[model samples]
Target: MATADGEAPRPEERQIEPLHLPTPEEIRGQDIWNNCAVRSVASGVMGGGLGFFMGMFLGALDNPIMQEEMTTKQQLIFQAKQMGRRSISSAKAFGIMGLIFSAAECVVEKTRAKHDTTNTVVAGCVTGGAISAKGGPKAACVGCAGFAAFSVAIEKFLDRHS
Candidate 1:
């Protein structure tokens, strides 16, 4: 359509809309997220199982003689402390393990796909620290898994919609 002057519309007067397209990098991002979801679930299960085993093993380490010789309150205190220690140790161990696992995954991604590994490592560390501080090893595992799943879901959703 032309204006009263019968001239084509100027470029400045025309609206320019930007088109969105998926780049190669975005495809890689989607793949990373898909992998992350699976890995997180696996890591959580393993960590939780290991923590349960460790807790059981630690609980069984009480000395029979020591138990028999202790006063009632002393025994109670000892038991409480032992339980507390187990939780603390389990959480710390799992957290550290989570970090290691993430690091390994990041390295693998870098080597195999030459993808951006930054997000994986950062997410792993955050998940590990959170689980360690709040839920112990079992909690850490669960948290990591959840975090991974959510992260992947969000990324995929954004990719598809955008």
Candidate 2:
């Protein structure tokens, strides 16, 4: 209803019932799941696209003569197929890594009752190492180190900025 001043009553002044909100624990759990799904999908798509372009570029660089021999349309089609293959490989790697990291985070949350940077780094390292294990021991070590470093850097940057 409008007040005498021709303005509606303020929300606080009205007889409004209290709204029920989920508890912090419930919110945290939902947030974790939501973030996991979103981040995993996004990472997969982005990684795939990046890998595709990089592979195409490197392929072209490796055999400039072969690229030059093909017609424009033919080259485009060939590059597209190559890019697609590389993209699929990268997408799978990133997708698996994201799933593993998410699962590890959930486990940590359940056991420790809190999420922290160390847990995130550990999860990343494990995921990266597992993904790279197909390459060799050295590659696995490098992947683990790279992921751990990346996670720590990101966490520190976020903490500093936030």
lDDT of candidates 1 onward, in order: 0.63, 0.70
- Return the lDDT, model 2, position 10: 93
Name the lDDT value of residue 145 in candidate 2. Answer: 90
Residue ranges of candidate 1 with Cα displaced over 4 Å = 1-32, 35-53, 114-162
TM-score of 1: 0.37
TM-scores, all models, native as reference: 0.37, 0.60
Best candidate (score: TM-score) = 2
Tens-digit per-residue lDDT, 132-151, candidate 2 = 89999999999999988887
Of the candidates shown, which would achieve the greatest lDDT relative to the real structure?
Answer: 2
Mark the regions of model 2 whose C-alpha exceeds 4 Å error after superposition. Answer: 1-19, 23-65, 135-138, 160-162
lDDT value, residue 92 of candidate 1: 56
